[model samples]
Target: MSITRLSDLADKAACPRLVVKVGSSLLVGPEGVRRSWLGELVEELAAARARGQDVIVVSSGAIALGAARLGLEKGGRGSLADAQAAAAVGQIALSSLWAEFFGTQGYPAAQLLLTLEDLEDRRRYLNATATLTRLLDAGAVPVINENDSVATQEIRFGDNDRLAARVAQAARASAVLLLSDVDGLYDRDPRDPAARLLPLVEGVTPEIHAMASGTSGSGMGSGGMTSKLQAAQIAELAGISLAIINGTYATPIARALATGTGTLFLPRRKAAARKAWLGGRLRLKGTLRVDPGAEAALTRGSSLLAKGIVGVEGSFERGDPVAIAGAEGRIVAHGLAEYDSRECARIMGHHTSAHADLLGYAPRSAVVHRDQLVLK
Candidate 1:
C-alpha cells in the first residue's frame, strides 16, 4: 500500500512489522556506544510496540566498537582476521548495549547473529524465521547482526543495510527503516549545493541507481547510499517498504514518524505466494523422483506422499529445499523436505503409517507438504 506518512508503519493492521537498521556511525561514537541516542530510539520503538507493531533491529557497530576497545585506529583493522577478531570482541558489547537500552523501556531484546549461510541455506533460513517469529510473539525486539566473527570475507555481507532487508524478508516485515548519516536519497550528489532530497521513491529504477553514492567516507561504517539502494531493491522484491533517514539527531525514529522525514521507497507489489525466498532464491540440495500419481497429486495442489515417491537423489537434510521430479525427469516443483535423503530412501515406497515401524519414530504426514511447495 501507499505510505506517505512514516506514522503508517506504526499501525499494526496497516504495517504490522518493521525492521530498523542502525549504522555503526549512529550506534558507536568516538567514546563508545551512543547510549543517549540509542535510549531515545528505544523509547520510540517501545511506543511502536505499544501500538502492536513487531520491531526488529539490524545494527552495525561490532567492528567499530571492537576497534575502539582494542586501541586500533578507526580503519586500522586491515586484515580479515583482525576484523573478525574485533567482531568477536564487539558483539558482546553491542548486544549488551541493545539489551540495556531496550530493557529500560520494558522490552526484552533478543540478539541473532547470522552469516550468509544462514540465509542461503534453506534449513537455517527456516530455523531463523521460526526463532524471529517466536521472539516477536513473546513481545521481544530481535536485534540482528551479521556473524562476522565466524564469517569469512567471501561469505560476509559487510553491510547491515542488506542484512536488514534480508531480515525483513525472513520476518515478513512490512517496512524497513534505515538510519544513516544522510537524511534521504538525493536527486544529485548530496555534497552539491543544488542537490534535492527525494522524499518518496515509487521504485528503484535505473535513474534511482544513478543517484546512489559510494560507500561512506566515515571509517566507522561500511554502508553508504549505494548499499542502501541495494537494500531497497531487496526489500522491493520481498514486498517490503524501505526508508532511509539521517539518524544523527536525537529520537530520529520518533521524529521521522512525526514529521515524515525520510526517503520512502515503496514496493512494486506484494511478495509472491508463500515466501519469495522459497520460490527460486534458494539452491536445491537434492531431488525427489515421484511417480505419476504423486505428480498428478502435486498438480492438484496435494502434498507428496511417501508411497508415491520412487527415488531420491543427492544428499539433503530435513528442512532443506529439494526438487520434485516427475515424468522424464522433468522437475514439477520445489519444496522443503520433510525427511532427509536417507530417510526418504527407506520410506520411498512405504506408507506414512509404516514410518513409525520403519524409522522407529513418529513422522510428518507428507514427504513434501504443499504449504512448502512452489509449482515449477
Candidate 2:
C-alpha cells in the first residue's frame, strides 16, 4: 500500500460514491443545534453533488439531542431505557433538521434507521442495499443512523464509526470520511504537547492501534480514536479508503476530498471480484453440508449440484447468502443460494434432474451456480 498526502487525493478526481460520518459532538452543542456549522456542511455536500458524486451521511446526534430535549444528563450514567427514549425523540428532530437543510439546497433527503442485525441478516442486508441504491439513483441523499430506539446492547453498533464503514460496504462506496472533534490520528493524544498528527496511513498496524487514546467524546458521542481505528480496519477489508478529520474545521469534507486535509487510511489492496461481495461482510443465513463428491467438485471449479448436498442447516430465503460446508462441517465457500431452505431440504441427495419435479418448476440445474460461489 502506498501512503500519500491530501495533495495527491485531488489529482485522482472525487470518488463516484462516498460515505461521510458526522459525530454527535459536531452537530449538537450546549445551546442546541449548531445552525451555522450545519449550513456550512450542507454547502459542502451540495458541492459534492454538483460534481456528480453520490453522497451518504451516517449521522450521530439523535441521542444527545433527545437527551437535551428531555432534560436528561449527557453521559454514560443514563440507563438503557433512558438512552432508547432519547434516541426515539431525537431521531425525529435529527431527520427533520437534515431534511430541511438539504431541501433548501434543492436536494431530497431520506432517513434510514438500521440495527447491526439489519446488515448481518442476509435478507435484510439485501433489502438495505437495494434501498440505498434506489435512493442514490433517484438523486436523494440518505441520512442513516442506528435504530437506537430499539437497539439493545447486543444489537447496537454503539458508535457511528463502524456503522459508517458498513454503510460504505453496503453502498459499495469508494471512500469514507469520518468527521469528529479531533483532526486525525496522532502519534499520541493531541493533548500531549509532544504529540504529532499522522496525515497519511497506509495501513492500520499494531503500532497504529497502540496510538488510539480509547477516550470517549465529552458530550453525547461514544467514539474515540480506538473506534475510528476499528472503522478503518473494516473499510480496509471492503476495499474502501477512510479518512479521519476534525469536523470543526471549515469545509472539512471538501478539504479532505480536494486536498487530503485529514489522516487517510488506504485499503490494503483491491479485493478480488468474488471476495468483494460474498466475503466476511455478509451474515450467513444457513449452511449447506455437502458430501465429499460435491466438495471435490467445488474445489475443481464446478457448480454445486443437489446430489452433492447431504444436509442443510438453518432457514433462509432463495437469494440469501449461505455457507457451503464440507463433510467435516468446515466452511469452504459462501454464495447466494439459488433455492430456499425448504426447497434445498426437499431436493437434498437427489439429482439435478429431480429439481423440476420436486419444486414443480425448473430454474437452473445447479443448486448454486459457479458464478456466485466464492471459495474460502
Clashing pairs in 2: 6-259, 6-260
Where's the lowest-lDDT run of ten residues in candidate 1?
Answer: 273-282
Off by over 4 Å in 1: 1-4, 273-275, 278-376
Best by lDDT: 1
List model 2 lDDT by residue over 264-361, tens digit each. 89877555534554654435789999999999999898999889999999999987888999998877788788999999999999987877898899
Q: After superposition, how far is residue 125 of candidate 2 from its true place, in Å?
A: 1.3
Please identify model 2 stretches exceeding 4 Å from their true place. Answer: 1-14, 75-77, 255-260, 272-376
Q: Could you tell me the lDDT of residue 287 within candidate 1?
A: 94
The TM-score that candidate 2 achieves is 0.73
Q: What is the Cα root-mean-square deviation between model 1 and the actual structure?
A: 8.3
